[model samples]
Every structure is written in structure tokens, then in C-alpha cells.
Target: MTARYDEIGVGYALGRRTDPRWLEPVVSALGAAASVLDVGSGTGSYEPPARDVVAVEPSAEMIRQRSPEAAPVVRAVAEALPFASGTFDAALAVLTVHHWPDWRAGLTELRRVASRQVVLAYDTALHNDFWFVREYVPEVAALEDSRPSAPEIADFLGASSVRPLPVPWDFTDGVFPAYWRRPEAYLDPAVRRSCSALAQTAPEAVSRGIDRLRADLESGRWQREHAELLELPEWDAGFRLIVA
Candidate 1:
């Protein structure tokens, strides 16, 4: 688990940043909190701005890419946070739980360290709904277990709200699901490198999928099959926010 990020996360921050739309819900979940713990904080993408945030990460490569302005980060993993119990007002783990060696232990650690928790995760129910997952890179979808959802997250952390977060057609965060309307983005090797789905998948499989996607796009078949998506401004692609 520790080695996965260092290997796949070398350039994670280049295209992945906090979408401004995500900040409002995160701040709302924080609810007047002054301090926060950013667990599995990769390149400080969603670590809240202008707040006292202490980040815990295990990968030296990921740590190296962290912005100069990000919160002071500790070289550690989520399962064993170094902070004392109740050390902060809130804790956040955004799109990161799936990578943990022991997710349950990590969630319990979050509960122990903070009074409130804000987590962003994807619902497995809609995993196959993505065109890339359904058609191009089925191997990428095979990597996800049947666990990452709002209710499951709420159950783990005892959260109060587990609601969906929409993905803008031109979503700026560049998370895997954010490219629902912009399928061509997947063609760029640099763009795909930012998402673990592409970075971690079997190279042969990735090559096969990219060829299929490129063929579909060049043939105009991709646009014909998913024409409605172009008009929609934002879409619900199984992304959700859990707040407790």
C-alpha cells in the first residue's frame, strides 16, 4: 500500500486540485471548525484553504509533489495517526480511503482524532455507468471493491449526511469520474497519469482501452452514443460527501 502511491503518484498534483464547488460542502461539514486533519492527504489537493490543517501521508514521492503553500505534512499513514485523541475539530479524507491498507482502522482513527468528519468518496453502484469503465478500461473498474459509497462511508464514520456531489461537465478537479462529458481527456497520457485508475491498471489493458477509445472518438461513435451528456452542465457520477 505504501509503495503504490510513491509509484503512481509522482505527478498527482499537476492536474488534480480542489474544485471550488467542493469547498462549500467541505466547509459546511466542518461547521465552524478551526483545525483539521487531512488523512491520506495527497499533494494537498483537498486540504481546506486558510485553515490549520495537519496532513498525514505515507508516500515520499507524493510528499515531494506537495505545494510549498500546503499545510505542514507528517510522513505517516492513516491507520496510525500520530496525533492525540480529539486533537482537532474536524478530519477530512477526500477520495482517498480505497488506497489504505486497512480502511476500517483508518476510519476509526479519524473518529478518534476529531469531533467532526468530512469525507468524499465514490459510490460503487455507478461505477459501471461511466463510459470509460463500461467500455474502455474494464480492468480499472475491476480494481474497485463494492464498498466506496455514501451510506457505507456514513456507517464507517457515523456520519450525519451522505449526499451526492455533482461533477461539472468541465469539472476542474480532474478526478477519474470528472471527465464524464469530456471523454477525449483520457487520451492524453499526462491526463490519464493523474488518475490512479489509469496509473495502476495493467499496461497492456490500458493500451488496449486507449486504442478502443481513440477509435470510438475518431469514428464519432462516442459522441453519438452519449450526446445528451454534452448539454448537461453537471452530472451525478456516484460521487458523494459524508459529514458527521
Candidate 2:
């Protein structure tokens, strides 16, 4: 499992670095914390530039791929964070909870290590409503169905409020479902490789889907169905920031 990230995390810095638009809300949720622990901090995508950040990741390749100036990374998993209790003012898990074999244990570890708060930025079932799932890749939604619900995540963290921050389509951080409005990106091999679902899916199915999408774009079918998206600068695809 750890090896998967090593193989896939090589191009992560160039393809998966955090977008500034989404970073604003995540930083705001940190709430002036002096120090932060970034769990599953692949290639330091969302690590804040100004704050003190300690990143934890199990994949050594990911750690090596991190920005030269990124916070020092500790090779560790979220279920067993290598930090003392209340070691950090805040802890953040971004798009990584679902990847954990034991989600509950990981969340407990995050809550235990953070003195002030735990902020999670992830997707929910609401992502299924996006055009990509509704059109080209319904199987990806099925793959993510196993992820814990937002309410469940909030409850596990003893969260008083579950804030849902709208992630605009212009928010191009390259996580799954971020390219709903830009259907052509899916046809690109490099872009598709960045998605775990597409990367892991049966190659035959992926090839077929890509072929279908190409045909749709060339035949004007995709534009006819989602033409409204072309004129709009942004869209709120169902990404949210849950502050606990």
C-alpha cells in the first residue's frame, strides 16, 4: 500500500500541489495556530507557507518529492502520528482520510495530537452530483462510497460545527473531481494518471471511457449537455472544509 504512493507520488509536486483558492479557506480554518501537523502530507501540497508545519507521510517518495522549502517531513501514518499529545496547535488531513485503512483510528490520532482543533478538507457524497460522475465515471463514485460521511467525520472529532466551504471549479488543485467543467482534461494521460481511481481501474475500462469522452467532445455531445459551464468562470463542485 505504501508503495502505491511512491510510484504515484513522483509527479505529485507538479500535478497535485495545492491551489491558492482552496488554501485560503484551509488556512482560515487553522485559526491563527502557531504550529500545524499535516497528516498524510503528500509532497506538502497544502502546507502553509508562513506557519510552522510538520508534515507526516508514510511514503518516502512523497517526502522526497516535497518542495525544498517545505516543512520537514516525518515518515509516519495518521493512525500512529509520531508526536506527543497536544503537540500541535492544529492538525489537518486533506483528501487523505479515505485512504486510511482505519479511518476512525486515524481521526482519533489527529484529535489527540492537536491542542486546539482538527481541520479536514475532503469530499462527500455530494461529489456524485458533479458532471464527471454523472457522465463519464460513475464507478469512481462507487469507489469513494466507502469513505466516511461528513456527519460521521464531525461526530468522530466531536465537532460542534461542520462547515461546508464551496470549492469553485477554477480551484485547480488536481484532486479527483476538480476538473468537472474541463472535460477535455480527462482525455490527457497525465491528468488521468493523477487520479487514483482512474489509475487503479482496469486499463481496458479506462481506455474505453477515454475513447468515449473523446468521441463526445469531437461529436459536440459533451458541449451540448454542459455548454453552460464554458461561459462560467467557476463552479462549486461539492468540496468542503470541515472544522472541528
Candidate 3:
């Protein structure tokens, strides 16, 4: 997690800013927890404003980009958290579980530190089916094959509930599938750089896909084929929130 993020985490805050929409769900899931442990909290994007939150991130590059006003952070990995058991009311891992080298151990640490665990993850099958990935960068599917599946994570966590999380059309956070409707956003270098999926994918494959997408857009082929997406308010790119 540290090494990979350290290389690709440069200017991470530019494209991965917090979307106001996410706060409501995250805060609600946190419930009445007074103190929260945010594991792998990148740039402190979605930390609840009202909670006493402590962020843990391994990458100095990611930590360096955190706002001065953001919660106090510890340079640490999820598998070996430094705190004692039950140190917080809840543990939160947002779009971060797959990054951990040993996710089972990381989750064990989450359970050790907090009474409740809340994780944001995605369904690999659904994510791979996204038009951009299905039609363009098929390499992403292969890349994700090694990552832990949402069900696998849920089973390990003994999740109480798992629900679908749809990506809003104009999502503020520039996650991999944030621009499902606004396809032009993916063409931007900065946008692609912010997403770990594109950053980690084979550069040649990404370039090929981007070139094809550009040509399709110019020739009106993309608009003609995915016209239905333009009218939707949100899309299900296989995102899910798990609570245990």
C-alpha cells in the first residue's frame, strides 16, 4: 500500500476531493460513534466533520497532501495498527481494503481496534462491466482479478449488511468509475492519474483505450452507443458499503 500509493499518490488531492454526497452515508453508517478510526484514509477526504476522527495512512505522499485542518493522522498500515484493542467506537475503510497486502490481517486489526467496522468496496464483476472497462481498457479486469472480492471481504468481516452504492452522475470524488456518465472526464490525464486502476494498468493498454475513446467521441460513436447513460442521474458501477 505504501510503495504503490507513494508513487501514484502525487497530486492525489487534485482529482480525489470529497464529494458532499458521500458524507451523509458515511456519517449515517458511523451512527453515534464519538471516536472513529479511519484506516487507509487517503488525504482525509471523507472523515466525518463532527466526529473525533483519527486517520491512518502509510504513504507520506498521500499524507503530505492532507489538509492542515484535517484530523490528526498516523503513518501506519492497516495490518499492524499501533493502537490498543477497542480504541475507537468504529473503524472505517473507504475504497481501501483492496489496497492492503494482507486484507484479512488488516480486517482483524480493524475488529481489534473498534467495536464496529464499516467498509466501502466495489463488486469486481459489475465494475468490469462498466462501458469504459468492458469496451476500452479490458486490462483493468485482469488487474482486479487478484484483488479481494466484495463478498470475500464481507464474509471475512461477518458483515451484518451489504448494500449497493450507486455512483452519482456528477460525483465530486474522481474515483475510477466516478465519471460513468461524463465520459470526457476520463480523457483527462489528471483524472486518470488520480484513479489507482488507470495508474496501475499497463500504460500501453491505457493509451490504446484512450485513443480509441477519443476517436469514438470525435466521430459521435460513443454518444450514439451510450446515449441512454446521458439521461441517467446515477449508475451502479458495483460499489457497496459493508457493515459488521
Candidate 4:
């Protein structure tokens, strides 16, 4: 996974900043835990600031991008966390499980290392409905199809609670679906550089899709079609939180 992230996740930190709104649920999921093990901690985006955290990620490039204020990060993959049993009060893997080559093993390690675990996941529902995939890049649907379902991830982690997390219309983070209300952002190569979906996709496909998207926006077709979405403060873009 680090190999892939290193290749496609270049300049990841520049655009993928933490959105404070996302912290509400992530921090809530931590509950009373004072210490956390952040597995697959890409750029330390959602790691709680108030808690003692030890981050583990596979990509050194991502580790290099972490803010000086971030937790001490270990260069390692989630498949094998270098911690003793019940080492931390909680663990977090946000928007990252899908990248693990051995997801079940990674979840097992997460459970072994912490009493509580939280995972943010994506699934097929939003893969088809998010206007981007439906309108521009249908190949992304194939990628989404290959990813583990939220329920599957929950079952693996022994999570009894799973809930939807909405994407704010003007979310600061540059995660794929976060730009649902701002379609023009996807056309910017620098913006796309931060999105694994666009970054890892075939350049020809991405260029063609962006061109069509540009055309639609120039003709006012995009706004005419998605006028109601403009009025929405938030929309469910298939992001799910699972707590165990």
C-alpha cells in the first residue's frame, strides 16, 4: 500500500488538510480514551490533538508531510502493527482501510492493539450516485466495487455500530467526494494530484473526463442538472464510520 501511496499520493498533504467538522465524529468515536494508535495515518489528518497518539503508516512520503505538531509516526504498515496487545485505549483508520493489501490482517492488528477501533469507509451506494462517477469517470465504480463494504469492515472489526457521515458542501479536506458541490475543483491537476482516484487512474481517461466536465460547466449544464445540490449544506457521499 505504501508503494501505491508513494507513487500516487505525492503532494498529498498540501491539499488533504484536516477539516474540523470531520473531527466531531472521529473524536466522539474515541470517547473517553486518552491514548490512540492511528493506523494507516496518512499525513496525520484526523488524529486527535488532545490525546496521546502513536501513528503508523507505510509511506515515508506521507510521514514527511506530517505537521511538526503531529504525533510521532512510525514507518510501518497496518498489516503488522509493532505494538503489544491492548497497547492503546483506541485505534483509528480513516479513509484508508481500502488501501491495505491485507485488510483483514490489518483490522485484526487494530483489534489486538486497542480496545476500541474506528474506521471510515466507502462503498458501492455512493460509488454510483456521486455525480462524479456517474457523469465523468465510471471506471471509479470498478475500484469502488473492489473495496470492502462498510458492513464487511465492521464485521471484521467486531463493530456493532455503523453510521453515515456527511460531506459538507464546502469541506476543506480534498478527499474525492468532498468536492461534490464544487465540480470545478476536479479539473485542476494539482487538486486531482491529491485524490488517489484521479491520480491512480489512466491519464487519458482523466483528461477526457475533465474536458467533458469543463464543457458541462461552461454550458451551465452542470448547475442546471445539480441545482438542488447547490442548496444542500451537506450530502452523504457514501462515507461511513464504524465503531467497535
lDDT of each: 0.85, 0.77, 0.92, 0.87
Tens-place lDDT digits, model 4, residues 1-244:
4367877778899899889888888899889999999998988999997899999988877887888989999889888898999999999999999888888998999999999998988765675678898889877777777778787898877787888889999899998887999999997888999888778678888888899999999999999999999999999887888999
Better of 2 and 4 by TM-score: 4
- Highest-scoring model, TM-score: 3
Which model is ahead, 2 or 4, in terms of lDDT? 4
Residue pairs clashing in model 1 are none
Which residue pairs collide, candidate 4? Answer: none
Q: How far is candidate 3 from the true structure (C-alpha RMSD, Å)?
A: 1.1
TM-score of each: 0.95, 0.92, 0.98, 0.96
Worst 10 residues of 3 by lDDT: 1-10
- Per-residue error for 34 in candidate 2, Å, reads 0.5
Candidates in descending TM-score order: 3, 4, 1, 2
What is the clash count of model 2?
0
lDDT leader: 3
